[model samples]
Target: MGRLGVPPLPNHALATRLADAYRAGTTVVLAAGDVPESLDAAEAIQDAWMASLGTSHAYKLGATIPAVREALNLPRSFYAPVPDDRLFRDGAAVPMAIARQTGVECEYAFRLARDLLPGPDALGEDEIAAAFDAILPAIEIPGTRYGRLAEYGGAALVADAGALGALVVGEPVTGLDPRALGAAPVRLSVDGTTVAEGSGAVMDGGAFGPIHAFVNRARARGRTLRAGEVVVTGSCTGYEVVARGPTIAAHFEALGRSVSLRFAP
Candidate 1:
């Protein structure tokens, strides 16, 4: 490949690369592009095509809803988190006000316990705020940029919502303690070497805020947050890519087990 500035490959070629990756069950991270100024129809073409596959979306950007809109074809589709989906976990969500960029680094995100907004039935503001308080945690990861200093924001709110699929991790906790919840230590390894280590506590304001925001957005669009939805808050640690044979593993210490995923060409 030429320099990053070189013209992008033809759409067919790009689609082939994405399709192959998806078929292999390997995760492919894409930068949700900035819009109007950087809005390339070709990029959206690729994104739309990818949604047909099993790829998932992440809202890493924190505050930039418009940018997220441009990156993901939101107005064109509705987003609801379902089982077997994944995104970047363990890192903080980026705000929407800045102009920063990051390369496609691989990361694994956690899914929320329920679908934020389901169907076309939306809710009022008061109802939404209470929902936010109900789902989010209180800890934060304290940072704005990733390893490459790319300005990340809440990408979930802006990306193609239908692309998400949550993995069925046993069952949801019902009578669990919320106030005294401790950060679960999760060990992440790349290529068999521990590159990043983090915990559930790494998420800012716990996981509820994002859920609330997501639900509110959906409700605004006349959607309802349904049960059994998946929401990956952010990355505990920034993304780390694997060029050759890298195997990524994550062990949620609280779960007393580990899961491994690999990147392949």
Candidate 2:
């Protein structure tokens, strides 16, 4: 492990090569059992990958729900950076060529108005909410440059930016109530059919829970949550794989907002 408690990266060349494949929009898979076993090692690989891509414009939390954690065999949640080029306005067209296996996540996303500097103490939910300038509906497109995500393990997923392919953010919701927002209902549909549905209650502490978790995680890694950065909380509807399709949509019922994406063949 590194001085910060993250494991030392065992394969810098592999990390750089994967980053290059991501940038080139090509699929590349590592040899079997080549993934990191510890969070620190995974974080180190992710840091290296992000450095090759340039600064991240947003962040995403993964495996926040019990079902997802169990599915990934993870004991807890994790965070990953999203490159700026991967963020898209609602209704943007996403080329299918960018990812090998595409999936969708319905989530609530926050855009921070003030910088959240790292400190010794963790921030509470209310404090996390106070830091956000806007709350919006979001559709997260998660994909893997690597083959068979389940074969690689959670640490490998973390290293590949939580398998983030793109983000589609909706219009900001006004008159936000923290309590109601936490319990808000969310649904995801593709090609006019409902594929997954759930509530904000599935989130760790409602909508703001993941933000607090993210802040603490960032601090643990000797980083800070900056202003003007968008943070996508864990999915309300678990990750649902998407076939090559024309469009995908997510609706935040209580928040009264929706986001959509069109996929190109």
Candidate 3:
């Protein structure tokens, strides 16, 4: 038994069950009070989930903004793996049947041009920016294989792969100005009505802050932040639930790039 008398599941069995739930497009709740309590346990579940997915294409940052932390009651930020199969380009059609309860979040994404090697010290914001070759507008669609996300704690959410459904990446923008980018406005709309909006400043450490933090955390876990992998930083606009009938779009005002997804009934 672990914290709160929640017995930990064997890594392989937990991963297999999670993967099955995802593939079957069904919800699977843990036993009452069975959530993992430590980051290590949560991360082990995360690793198992990622391994089950096979290929890792991108990373998603969670609780990067104060609002998110407050809403989820998390003390700090966390990272989750985004598998390649869940990534889609702009204007992709998302099947609502696959993701029953979907929400959208506007975000900034960066793709590294060079490998970020692990070191004793954490990478600074400027160094993190320099490592990226391009910046892009992104919209993250979050879904859960649970009945209600609020019922689960932060560690449980982490083990559930951050509730990430799919990432819609827009066209890459080059020659970005850091200062200007950090102040950029982002908006999310459902069926032409704007539901949520904010700026890069909404993130606790600014636009590049999450990237810096993710790298350091990964390195600390004996993992390397590889090149050619996309990093979807924290959302500028908070998560807004989108109904099945509407078209959802996220616009990056300064970058002049937008990504849209339509849910098919």
Candidate 4:
């Protein structure tokens, strides 16, 4: 039942190539015949790729916004597990080589306090925050090895591990009021010039919708979110692809949490 198209499951050769490209901080432009054509085949390859790397950090969601879903023609949100080396701390710099090739997104993120259980309804804001030990303002650079992005669609992205280029995690918010996150303002800037701005209210039912969607879907696949793993919702401000010289920044109104990353050229 899991086979969607017909390439075969756990494509180890593809997984190895992806793992190598990701660790080298570069992307691969796949050919038409190379793209994963189905969600089942794509996700299976991703699973195998994750196993090949042995890296753990977080899970990221994409296409959470209704407009984005419609635009991408996605049936549901997409998920990818991030590797530790690709994640950065606040105030650091993304190596210029990679920064020049990708874009950045401002997002609301959280770390789980315990394992997550699959559920039917959306978790209330306070209840959702209660399940977490930290709230983070983040910048996600969704990178993909399959370079011609518009051609492949969701299946290709799922195979490329949600196209996660890199992530810059902001300082943790110490006293966030989850109840207020629905209206929390998020901003993204380049060299201190505001490029895009939006609030958490834009997500389906506040920012937690992605997490709930991820949890239910993941559990159905026999996976459960564990403590200490981070979950990043889709971008508040759509991702901005820029050049290598300027500083990229993100800020969230959750107790003034922010992330500032310089690009080293």
Candidate 5:
């Protein structure tokens, strides 16, 4: 749905259009591909885009403590695929794998809205607040973009062919208090049983700092950070690799909301 039907635009072009639409106070979302061929292309595209955008890259957490990391035995690196915009508009399934080295865990963070905020960059708090008015509750689907820690460094890993995962836009979290909103406990359940837990504290003690930093990094590049853009600062907790054939739910405790997801083989 971009550029007057020009082959639906390449993944990179589609991503730019999604950001542009968000800046224009319009919402846009897309789907993601799990196929290795498509995954490789998507990751390549995102690495180039992030580099061009100069956005800061970081992983989400499942919880706030080291104890959780010990429990999951997460690896330092992960595999990720570039997601379509629709997934951002609606909740989507995310697949992840644990690494044998680095022992780093990964988690998913739900960030809605297409608005951007002010930071050391040009926009100020009041301006940002005003722009955020049209924000929506878009979900951020994060997974292992990179294969493993031994495979590459964080930046390199993300730049690699397999580092980007699906990014979708889902239901808009209404009445999200930008000022009052910060980090808190986030929970996830599978078949009514808790499978993952995380906290907002992982995002630089709260959502503001890290989210701002992320946007600022993006702004540093050629792209302009607009208002009404919602971004999930990063994972409050690390990654939680789920098993096959199960129903999953992610809850943002601080906000008192939850999203249900169905996974496919």
Candidate 6:
């Protein structure tokens, strides 16, 4: 039984399906019995998958914007612990032979200087400010293992590891005020043509906002954001659904950095 005597989530079966789909790089359409009906159940399934995967390499946050949350029927942002296998450097050609569709979004990716473990009391401003090492321009290629991806709501996304497919990072920009990043303008280009434009302010205040939220939330669950780990906050520009044959680029102009990847089918 769960905390309130509800039967515990059948995380094992679902996690196995998630893990198998990860290994096979294929889609999974969950049956009613395997589908998670609640956010708690979805989180349990994600944790189970992570446990089976052995270790996590990075964290990805999504659906941070209030409007986006409303569209997904989510009360808050979602996060996923991604494996290193999908963390690609800029200029890498991502093989998309099996993918039917993929979406790209741009954002700030922060590499932590030290662990951000919760203290006995509330975290102060200095503690939050000191947790950063550098910021990088990032474009996330978020995907799903399930069919009719949009029909599934936030809980389904949380279960599918925030729909994280791959993350491509550009050069890190340091020595800049992390708080000021919220005002930075970001542009997304496809095949050298602009497709989307926005600023970091859309990311729930800034790049660090989601980090702050995730820290407190994880700490409550007895987890810590360890040193040297990367936390990628949600999109600045919304997203582009790339069907095939396009080079996507994200430009974080204020920081003078950009990153890009090509989809090769």
Q: Judged by lDDT against the true structure, how good is candidate 5?
A: 0.39
User: Model 1 clash tally?
Assistant: 49
- What's the residue-level lDDT of 76 in candidate 5? 24
How high is the CA lDDT of each candidate model? 0.36, 0.77, 0.77, 0.74, 0.39, 0.76
Q: Give the winner by lDDT: 3 or 5.
A: 3
List RMSD in Å for every model shown.
11.8, 2.6, 4.3, 3.9, 11.4, 3.3
Give the worst 10-residue stretch by lDDT in candidate 6.
1-10
User: 158-223 in candidate 6: lDDT tens per residue?
Assistant: 888878688888888889767777577899998889888998887687767777777666665556
**Can you write out model 1's per-residue Cα lDDT over 1-265, one digit (the tens) per residue?**
0112223433444345444543443434445442112223333333444446553332332322333344544333223332133332232232211112211221223333445544445555455433322222211112212222222322322222222222212222333432223466656666577766665454334433344455544445433444433344444444443343354455555444455533332
Taking the tens digit of each residue's C-alpha lDDT, what string does model 3 give over 5-73? Answer: 223444666666677888888887788546776656766776766666767768898888877778776
TM-score of candidate 3 against the unseen true structure: 0.89
What TM-score does model 2 achieve against the real structure?
Answer: 0.89
2 or 4: which has the higher TM-score? 2
TM-scores of the candidates are 0.44, 0.89, 0.89, 0.85, 0.55, 0.89
Candidate 6 achieves a global lDDT of 0.76
Q: Ten residues in a row with the worst lDDT in model 5?
A: 1-10
As for lDDT, the candidate ahead, 2 or 5, is 2
The better candidate by lDDT, 1 or 6, is: 6
lDDT of 4 by residue, 1-265 (tens): 1212334564667777878887775566666777676677788888777766666668888878888778766677778777787788888778855553657788888888888654344455456567777788888877777654545777777788877677888777646554358877788888889889988777777787677567666755556568888888888888687767688889786657678887777
Cα lDDT of model 2 by residue, 1-265, tens digit = 1123456677787688778878777766777666777766777888777766767768888888777788777778888878878888898888866655577889888887788765567777777777777778888888776765555777778777778778878888755754457666798888778888998788777767766777876876667678878888788888788777568899888877889987776
